[model samples]
Target: MNNFRFLVDPVFSKRFGIAPFIGPKRFRPPALNINDLPDDLDTILISHNHMDHLDYPSVKQLNKRYGERLTWFCGRGTRQWFLDNHVKNVIELDWWEEYHFSKKEVNIAFCPAQHWSRRTAFDTNKSLWGGFAVWDTTHKFYFAGDTGYTHNISIFRQIGKKYGPFNLSAIPIGVYEPRYMMETQHVSPDEAVQIHIDVQSKKSIGIHWGTWALANEYFMEPPEKLSQAVKNNQLHPSSFIVVKHGEIVDLP
Candidate 1:
């Protein structure tokens, strides 16, 4: 992302949902809390309006710390939520739309993802949901916030053709079990590996796992399955890796 700093889908709360403790419980704590994040972050990217990814407590803390100086980029129909919460620096984008920073050196594009959005009983699909394709003059990156592996397969190939060969990328690789119910919304580790190739990511990391006990899979199952998928595909293990929670990884 060039020299720009960004945070995506930040959640510091231990419980997620409409109420304090009425939702899924976080099994592991974040590597760094809102107070411990790097001081230089000027942007936040939210893929959708899911309570887990768009934690209210974290948003308030971020807005208070950065105010209008920090910009919030989210999917369509999501800006109103931030505005209602007094966050005035928020911007929303539709799928395939690109937003350029004031510097004109950085670009953020919202890409279509096979996922649904809902924060309440009546708001299902009211807001847009998707992944991000971001880049600067020197680096290209993709963040697959949360998506399932579509049988069509070409959707991801389309992403690679449009904006890919990413220097580094982050793709979801967990919360996928009991394929009967989860297959359409979350990708298994094996499918995640295919997405790595379909998106042409040079180096990718597994995310959205080992944090909350939202799915039926074991906490340690994701990385283990992902490792096997990498080998099954004959790709280098480092090409797609799962790091310890709170681990700092360097990107080329």
Candidate 2:
């Protein structure tokens, strides 16, 4: 399955900005470069419109190269970004909505994620923000795109009841230090572990960390914190994994 590629939130850049002082500068670069992408990429799942998630240049380049062969799925109101770029096959989905690809035998459902979206000041929260539940005959995976720990625990519980007990999940685990500022939008490591339980995932991996130091916490602190959180929650070492950049795992 080396040629089978599906990219999620692929941002390969030095900063999250469209113009000067628009967003924070990236502390590090993406592990995978856009040019390194496989020629026969299957699909692209975009979660939101943040510069880090919905990169304009990357999208433009991919569309220019792959065109209609690449299918783009994103949050409800995020369709315009790609349409404006002249992308041919863009699918926008609302929360709890499902899209089926019969040929690929895959189903993708948009799910609730407690977060906000904004690429510019006037467009704050104008677009939808959420996670995705992707499933096929053999695997069920949840991608909690970008979210915060909120009172809406039922959102995940509902996901668990509706489409979960997932085989694997990708949850955010960093850029959440100094809770006062980030509590409304980012989930901490402990909260990420809670999400794993909430979603009833058999195995999960910590993401949204290591690539960029966007918060006050030290760059190397997330993995250590994730380890402690798992231990404190009495979870097995393999239940929630911390993978190195560019590392490959053979999912069973």
Note each model's CA RMSD in angstroms: 1.2, 2.0
For each candidate, the alpha-carbon lDDT, in order, equals: 0.89, 0.85
Misplaced by over 4 Å in model 1 are none
lDDT of 2 by residue, 1-252 (tens): 223358888776566677535667776666677678888888899999988888887787788888899999999888987887899799999999999876577888999888989877788998899999988877789999999976645587888889989998999998998999998789999999998999999999999986665789987888899999999999998999988778887777
- Which runs in model 2 stand beyond 4 Å of their true positions? 1-4, 19-25
User: Could you tally the backbone clashes for each prediction?
Assistant: 0, 0
Q: Which pairs clash in the backbone of model 1?
A: none
89-189: candidate 1 lDDT, tens digit per residue: 98899998999887547899998889999988989999999999999888998999889887766578888999998898899999998888999889999
Q: Pairing residues by index, what is the TM-score of model 2? A: 0.93
